[model samples]
Target: MTTTAPASGAHAAGSAAPGDEPLLEISDLDITFTTSTGHVNAVRGANLTVYPGQTVAIVGESGSGKSTTAMSIARLLPPNGKVTGGTIRFGGKDITKVRNREILALRGSEIGLVPQDPMSNLNPLWKVGFQIREALAANGVAQGAQAKRRTVALLEEAGLPDAERRAGQYPHEYSGGMRQRALIAMGLAARPRLLIADEPTSALDVTVQQQILDHLDTLTGELGTAVLLITHDLGLAAERAQHLVVMYKGQVVESGPALELLQKPQHPYTRRLIAAAPSLASRRLVSVKERAEVVEQARTTAHAEAPATTGSIPRSASDTIVSVEGLTKVFPIRGSVPWKSTPFTAVDDVSFDLRRGTTTAIVGESGSGKSTVAQMVLKLLEPTSGRVLFEGRDITEIKGRDLLALRRRVQPIFQNPYGTLDPTFSIYRTIEEPLRLHGIGNAKSREAKVRDLLEKVSLPASMLQRYPNELSGGQRQRIAIARALALDPEVVVCDEAVSALDVLVQAQVLQLLNDLQAQLGLSYIFITHDLAVVRQIADHTLVMERGRVVEQGDTETVFHSPQQEYTKRLLGAIPGGSIPLAGSETIEVEVDTELGVDAEAEEIAERDGARSPLGEEPTDPFTGAGHV
Candidate 1:
């Protein structure tokens, strides 16, 4: 990594890069959060810069204060965070002293932000057109038809289809990739000079994530907008960014060129992070005859283990886990005004199978019916029209005792582990409750099992007593996995499960999942928009768009030689091949989320108790397919 040779006595990373002056300069930036326990100095004294038209990435694990640093620049940090000490200068202006209005203008017009999740970023109530107008209006653009016209042009510019039609639809109406495009459109509406993307592609499937990243790269190159990318994915930072910033415990542990920092990272954190991300080489080694076996298995309806175990996921007839046929989901557009609009097809004719013990990833942007498919598979909602087979039996209709039986066979790990579990419940109770319900053991035995599960995840038993809030992002996620594993179902549906985690944590979690799969012979439906992750873990890949499969094949074939332009765009968008960072040899997931055990987790109302008749945890949080 270039940062390995950053300015030492004279060329400290805080210094200017060679001759060019920085466009955005931050010096000795110190930020802290006032927590009840004490003060969490999220961003310690740190220094960094983004030169003209240069992209600088702040890479770190969770609680590294990387996000805190960027958010402070835009004055977007939460109420608890304070810029304790620092000087932020943009275009020679002291932003620290700038008024709210000027800072606001600088935000949308001079700087754009592509937030983490499309679902939360875009307004569910407004149309793409209105949101664009709102953005422009905030940037001093006059409101009216002119703004509407520009909105359509911008949508088309961002590569959305039927811009005119999409303009009138709500956030729920657009596909996942399309929604991200719309959010990008909103950010670029006023032609900002800089773009701040916080985990922009984290929640997407690999294909859609790539497209969005490619679009951003093209847009920035064309408009010369400086980019400040904050992420945990080192591969992404290395692939797309020109410069790098590594943070740890709110400190600038390291900073250098993206390529340099990745290839020859000096900091231990940087090394660990790069080591966590999966690469083609590592994937090839771990998956036996991965490519050959995937094609062979894809053609052969009967599932069985591949001859060579180097390039593919293990297979079994019973492992021919989930199969979907002619799935259709439509939503009625309810308008208060009479004859205002019509219903639309959200997902149509989606069919695919998740073979046993293998990872069949569903790749797409947001709202592409990926999540809808997952929901239907989990029988969270009856498919608008379709059939779902679990272990060769229709699960869509199964209920009562039979349905409970199916639930035990399938388990899910959600995207945001923090939000998946309850803030109130301790990890101990959370993981143990499921064990008790399944009649696996009594209170003592269940507690021991919970602790054992935590140990398997590399967490201490003491963590089981603490609430979700006390743990780090990666740690909380570990708990979530332990809880999911309590049932040890035949199939696991992970919906963007590792997206929110920092790169190292993400890697750890992915590795954990991989280990679990090998040890337990588990089957998984791994849904994500991360190509990097898909390339490493997926046995077979299915690319989705507008609620349909645009491409489906073995992982290597699909990634190395994509058949569809959309697929190509998605692959190209991933921060791969370019970044020369150390890559992971395993798919281990380590993350923390506030979502923990809740009323929903417990079966208090039902006589069956919390124990799923299927002997598994219950959640409709989009694990059958991946969604944001």
Candidate 2:
């Protein structure tokens, strides 16, 4: 094991030599978690380095030890987890040998960490500004009114809108992207030498993700902070990082320049990852004919066997399964007068149709009323006005057995697999619960049905005895899909279903959905914030903003020739759209001197017309509504 110290003095930006000592180094690293059953080796012989002002990305699937390795640097590992053998050096000091107090002091002052899942990381009760102030206070950066002012400045630097007003808001009040930005502000409050961002943008929208990354790149460059980004998005890694580290099964499989590794991957796992990434599946939306050709080509190239055929279930473009018309949902907000309340329209005059055996995607940022429409269609929530017709029948007024029948026909696959699946239920029980509820079969027959569903979702029958906790995020989601299909539903509502998954798992899940639709002639109302996924699976698209349908058309027309400005902005927000894998265009990080605080405030006021670096609005007013 070996470690190297960072350069003692300042150096020109992006001028680090291959022979120059790294700011942080890790060698022959190994980590293990002590569990009740036994000790699990989490990391093995992992090696990495981060030079001054360099952005290095570690890319891998879940449980590949990327987060484990990065968390070990800050000693943020859980009590049961420990580094068995490794050398972690930061600025000439060996972190593994540092005392508790020394490591505590080194955390925010030397190496700042932006943890994954802002909803879990941020203190829900405290104000966002207070949290930022706490970070500043810990590092002795500012105090009193100065600290408050600095917090707002940091928020603005993070590209957050209404920095002053947002600073006074609670964590629950902010959107996922806003909460993430708050965390980033806290992480960079003291301007640490190295920033360890663990899946920082996983929960964010594409445009917000790009903006946050851009701000980090610019600010970190000015401060000369080295960055170690841990993520599963291979396209993001390729686009942002100078160097790439590929991890598989706790081992460093490959490491090299980002573009070189992406273009010509040396490891089989890396190649498989690239193939499974949905963002890299197609650069842009294609015509239906083109999509079919591409799918056929992929099938022929990847598999020696002939492609599987769809079932003989008949479906046509005009056969509408779920029809929504002039749907509106309003909630009453308590006003200053006890007896009176203000009406808040969550969904207003929204209309869309889900055709038989085809996927119709509702695309928008958070709070754009996508999920509200889905809930209305599913009869989970009644609209304040308008109607939902299921199979040419009004389901809005249906109740009792009728609603139960509707449940059997329309099922949902929610966003978080961890939250959706019951932890106490085994896989067999989880899948069979739906069958039991619908009285489809006897106990013995239900078990058989569960086993069949397991096979359908591509899970082994042996997993029937395993509990939800025993499964990975991908596996749990597969179980959820199996459970949803237990009663042979005709329509499925997938609400941000694959947003949290890694690219590889997301691709597999999307394929599974496509296959199921083909096999059973099922229709889908896919609600999501990801435009990239919409381009892949949707047959038709509906663009929503502030509870209204901005645009609706065939997938090809909507994506290729968008008639709405919001739709165009969504398309433009896709990361790596302009940047290519083979290109030599580096990430430019020049600070914008023209962007002042008052100017940013003014931009916030006129956000609807103003544009981000990607030529989109900075904030969506409805971005916080009805999200998972």
Candidate 3:
């Protein structure tokens, strides 16, 4: 095997010729873990190649070994895990058996990693800049004042605003997206030949996700870096990667050009992933013109009946389930000196009406007050001004039994199920806890209720004895849903409910929610940063910026004819939104609404100068599919 000199800094653009050696090559790789139960084969016979300046994505569901394979490349696997067989070649040298000193030398300078879950990966005790500077120092890249300056530069390049101030803050001070960007900055600080990004943008909002990915593209292009992307979001894989590898059941099932595989996937798992991706759900949504016409006709009809009501007005009180009236929340930012604190407004005059049996999505990036609004609605937080009315009753000051009654009628399903769920509680106990708290049924009856709820979520009765740790991410979320439904709530506040699940699992959970809503007449206040998900689940959309609602309307109308630049940018930033999926181009949206409203829509489009919601031609970039 041939060897190259250690890289002192970022490689020049196009440093390696077209026929040069592949930067990373894995052949017949096998990985195993020794658990208390027994030996588990995490990966088997996996093979992939990454040439310099190329991007390859590994796509799979949880337990599909995508992350495990990436972890092995950096030799960062858990202590219980081992590379039992096969070869991993880097720079033409077999690294599967490399020494510790040699591996340490290769880590940051040769192989960098941007791990998933920024909070856990980063040290909470250290300042963000100190952690990054440590990477530079450990890699012998820079130290002292030079390393500090480099750290701030890396943070800026990773899309973090106010990099200098942010560097001094701890991980807890930064939001999830900011922390992830910091991790990205640290990973690229040494300019490694390969960057193993494991779901780097999963927790980020759409616009920031785009910015970070764009930054990665620029840095990698300039440095001739090879990227091995591990993600469950196929739309991201389809749009960003030149090659796609599909892994299932601890093995590589298929690998090929990204677009071709997405358009004509051979494996059943790959096909299912493509079919379930929410990013491609835009094709299923009504066109901007169609939605605009529908709204216009609806308005015309409503106007003929009630002269005062406008299209922008929230639904009438008769059908409205929950009304948020000028909701606002102010948090105090404590200063170093006692009693010196600044008030931070989290939600400013956010008003909306959630109609019965429909979903209202609050969409925005972090710190946009989406969660604050949800909290106020759930009665988890107090609003400094404004009120939340449930079924025409103000819930702000309710206490004791009234609050208990409200809790029974309204429930919340939070983003991270693992964080919310008690690890000590079995599935049965977790679901039963809610029923017990409400004193709804006897122990025997509650057992039956728990079993029925499991069936509602499509989970087996056998899982009742399992702990949360034993369940997959999707399963945990389903359990959360079951618990939320235990009280037979009228309204459910799902905060980033399915954002962490794989595409297929997310599709299933979304379908389950829709099914539940249809059967039980439930209203959902869905708070999320993913516009792709909003298209699939929300009936109405509210776009927030800073702490204010910049736009609000029917989901279709708001998505297609966004009035605000922030909304337009969010829509454009959706991964795979611009990639036309196969068969999506020719799908027609047949509208049976009143005719002659198209002219009004055109007039509005001209008045607003709104860009096409989907941006360019609806052609799948991966498949080279033609425009719609």
lDDT of each: 0.72, 0.77, 0.80
Best-fitting candidate, scored by lDDT: 3
Give all TM-scores, in the order shown: 0.74, 0.84, 0.84
Screening candidate 3 with a backbone cut-off below 3 angstroms (N, C-alpha, C), the clashing residue pairs are: 259-622, 580-619, 580-620
Query: Residues 115-174, candidate 2, lDDT per residue (tens digit)?
Result: 999889999889999999999998989999999999999999988888999999999988
Worst 10 residues of 1 by lDDT: 593-602
- In model 3, which runs have C-alpha deviations exceeding 4 angstroms? 1-18, 156-167, 285-317, 585-628
Cα displacement (Å) at residue 621, model 2: 45
RMSD of 2: 13.6
lDDT tens readout by residue for model 3, 9-76: 21122244555677888888999999999999999988887878888899888888999999998798
Model 3: lowest-lDDT 10 consecutive positions: 1-10
Give per-residue lDDT, candidate 2, residue 580.
Answer: 60
Q: Which candidate, 2 or 3, has the higher lDDT?
A: 3
